[model samples]
Target chain A: MDAWFQNEVTYPHVAQEVLDAADSVRATLPNKYCDPEIAANLFAEAIDEYLLCDDLGINVICTEHHAGINSLLASNPMLLSILASQTKNVRILSLGTLITLRPDPVRVAEEYATADVLSRGRLEIGFVKSGLSEYASNQASPIDNGDRYWEAIDLISKALSHQEGVFSWEGKHFTHRHVNIWPRPYQPTLPRMWSATGDPSTAGDVGRRDMVQVLVLRGPEGTKTAFAANRRARAAAGMPKPTTDRFAYAALVAVGDTHEEGVRMGEKLMWFLNTSLRSAPQFGPKLPGLAPPQAAPGLYRTKPAAAKPGETASAAANAAALMNITAEQAMARGIMFAGSPDTVHKQIMDFHEAVGGFDHLSMIGRSGFMTHAETSKSMTLFGKEVLPRLKEVKTVTAGYNQPD
Target chain B: MTNATALPASGNLLIGDIELEVVRRGVGQPMLLLHGFQNIEPDAPFLDMLGDHASIIAPSHPGFGRSSRPKDVETVYDLVHCYLALLDSIPDEKVSLMGFSFGGWLAAEIAVKAGRRIDRLILVDALGIKISGPETPDIFDVFNKHPDEVRKRSWHDPAAQAPDYDALSDSQLANISRNWEALCRYGWHPYMYNPQLKRWLGHIKARTLVLWGASDGIVTPAYGEAYARLIPGARFETIDAAAHHPYLEQPRAFVDRVSRFLKS
Candidate 1:
């Protein structure tokens, strides 16, 4: 199993009273609260942590989130460039630029090519089907976002790999009259593409396209459902089965010398869920195209109506459900792997067993008030103790046990 | 056309493949009413009063109310063309066209293209043309602003005029959700206005009336005044103690203005 070290470089120093007063901590809150010096320091420390991960031989993932306290890495390629040039032994995954919000995918392709060249072919491109506050900040419409997502990916892929000179792409969402990038990606074809999504509706598309699909923070049941959807889609399309390496699971992880210390650090990660997720109604339940109109009863009512059986709940509701969750509950739900090295290893193996299997574990090691020293220590402990044991788990052929 | 989960069950018009929820009332003169941000409420008092003056044919825009919206029918250009087809379907008679808020943009576009089909036109708190420099936004962004700010700017008397969300039903909320999504799809970029529409406003052959809510902050009455100036011989008027939805806030006054204009 491949383990990835990820950090969102959150700014968690804001006063609790200020957070309480603001309707949302993202998009709307004035940037005066984000001290530039503190942000700079956070970035520097985060980069250092990535270097430590490189030394530890853990692959690094660069993520992007815009205008939010949740993540300071607003530009994935910027950080991916640093990781590509600075880190010697590790793989750098850009998981990734918010492509749906961007006007041009051709420029994105250029950036990926540059980064891949810098890394000497270690770059892995990932796309995020970003939504909610992203639409508000980036001036991108949530409606038809799906159309844009696929079209952007297609454009980017073609731009990166097309060796046959200038190509014109006039798709439904993107139009590049002259499409060509200099010094095409270092990889023989293109870097392995990955997509992070929680929606079952689009998981099928990811399966058909054969991009690595990462389910972030979805519990065992939700992850299993999405994975099954992917397999079912592949089977329906008469496609060959994949291996476990094609699937990835992302979760908050903390490792310490002792079990008690690790759980305590894991509690600090809850700030990401409790505070940073406090988006206004417009960006949450009221977000256009976030869910079908059938789910409005559960969205609009102060006391939401009980969800009907077989109905898919909105991602907003899922985020809302996690806001007040305790560390114990997080661990129980398989969203967090925390404790001493042995305990954490056991917890990971248990989650691996719960869901059929995933060969890539994307670990969010640093977030919300987690100090740099603590983050580094946790990374060291994870690298030294838990990683070797995890590597023993073999990647199995990917096929959902056909549900009777 | 693929059947959306939402069907225009209450729809009365079959414009080509598109089905629309329409409210028909009164007798005499044909008046095609285009709704604003959301579908016009069937029971709005202005409808009854406006009906007294002229025949009213109000069809909810596709993807609004219960109207089915095919994925292809998402742009303002599509709407303008659809309504033109609607006017053609009416046959020999020239119709008076009226639109509100987002619908006003659609109505204006259609009026420009369907010159001979539309005999007269009315735009109520309409949003279509860009009136100011790019940096200074002429219309308030409803999607980006706080909901409180949106309501406060939207109505002169928000306490009384705002829809009671808690009082609304599951279906009402669902309809609102659908309307919001569709509105975003049509208007999000270039943000509620067609950059080229201002130049084409002069092409409208219909005698036009531009109505506004005096306190409408979403798009100020000043913007409406500028909009009227772009069109040929269009009259501009404002209703007192009202904001964006003048028809909802002061229904009698709203109808009074429309009736007087239609008769003239």
Candidate 2:
């Protein structure tokens, strides 16, 4: 099976745990954790184990959180420079720096370009809107959030691709002076750009921009809306439709000899996420400009009555009483995919067909609360049993050109 | 237009210019506290912490708190320049700078320009460094999700529970929205700061302290350390049992750390 491992690295304390957990998996599977420098040594050790696998790659999605955990690491640009020197053959995907949140798109173009060049064109970028909490905590008004997000994207793209010395933009939210990004990206016309979103509008917007769409498989139904929106938007934007083969679908996956054991382990992790870890407060109070649902009472649940027809059936049900959805709905929707190899294979096929086929299937073998041993077991099971089945299924082609 | 008045009892130099109202307090060892993306008060723990040792100047950056929205000041750098002018108005030859969230980023910019005039700098849960990894969710996204889910994502400390939105007064919500708009004006840029700011840290000669809540879900600790390392000789610390605004959650610990840092 073609396997892609996806994980998040936060600050040092948490990142170390994530790296260690990832290491446990490397002992058994071809895996990599998109991590930062504070966890570099641990990541290096994980790589040592990972390299044992015949075909493997490491993707370091570097960011400021690494610096936030320790004072010695340089800021983003310097950190990217450091990342360039740290490893080889590992694809460096900048999940994305919020280009829209920046005042100078030219600078973003220049920096990411430098990063791509430094990493020998290993850079893959993803852009997103700065979270509302980030804006609020930083004292940015919600009104400017959307405008800034798009503006930054526009400027960055222009600066990265433009052959001329100057580019200009005049928007209601931001104005520029002699816009030009120095030191263009290593890849021709900038490395591939991706946009991450959990919302349909956002997914569609990314497709409209002709960028890759990174969809988090929160649940089966939500995934459907994301796929549908993306497809529709891509078609409308006159961009080539993203086949399941071009997209990456990520979900929390755990494999075991028996379906019950994996489910038990996965559920335990979910309980931790849904309980102990879920107590942190929202950054700021809601704002008027936000959509009604976003500003409404229940968090993360779409209101059932408002659910669009053809949206996930589970999402519609959850929306109706989102604050009160049972664990069964969450499980059946594939929010947390757990099973034996046979079960997992079936689920993968279903998901692949559901999304019209994904180029890569990334499993988050570790999360905020999962321990190393548990993740390792899941990784081992996946590598030995589930992967073979995935490899055998040749109904669809691989997404990107596989590394030689 | 609100009137400009200085408060002798609080030692606050108050400047109310139609669109903005600024409050400056304390004395001896001048320092500036740039408020976050929200309305703040004199009683905020960080302000209270530094009040004892320095001439603490806390301004409601235009379009926040009691500050009116000034048409003239648009970008975050504009606010930075305005604050620089405020420091120039003071009698002290130099000043220490501290900012929280958006203010922290502004302080960095001001310090870069003020150079030798800034003796020390502290940024608490500051924003405006660009790192590429897991996307930091926006406040709106958090609120849309379960409050508990948002909290878990942000706070390292279990004690930092989500705020009871139902309990907040209308005025509080209104103030938050008003300030959020102002924040968008300055922070809408992706990566939050000029990418050049990373390299510019070499220009800032002041001793710096970068502090964050161990559990902060907003900017994440990784972003915090990035800021600290960018500045020469900057130190980093995490406040236990705190989220994005440690000074608000663990006032005593927050103050104690600042007191020790400033003293050193």
Per-candidate TM-scores read: 0.95, 0.50
Cα error, residue A215 of model 1, in Å, equals 1.1
Best by lDDT: 1
Query: What is the i-RMS of every prediction?
Result: 1.1, 7.5
**Residue pairs in candidate 1 whose N, alpha carbon or C atoms collide under 3 angstroms:** none
Off by over 4 Å in 1: A303-313, A399-404, B1-11
For A1-404, candidate 1 gives per-residue lDDT tens digits of 98999999998988999989999898988898999999999999999999999999899999999888998888888898999999999889999999999999999999999999999999998888888888888888888788899999999999999998899988898889998799899888889999988777788899999989998888877787778778778878998887788899999999989999999899988889888988887787677877789777767776334333433344666677778898899999889999999999999888777767889999999999878988999999999999988888898976434361
In model 2 chain A, the worst 10-residue window by lDDT is A22-31
Candidate 2 chain A TM-score vs. reference chain A: 0.70
* Candidate 2, residue A172: lDDT: 59
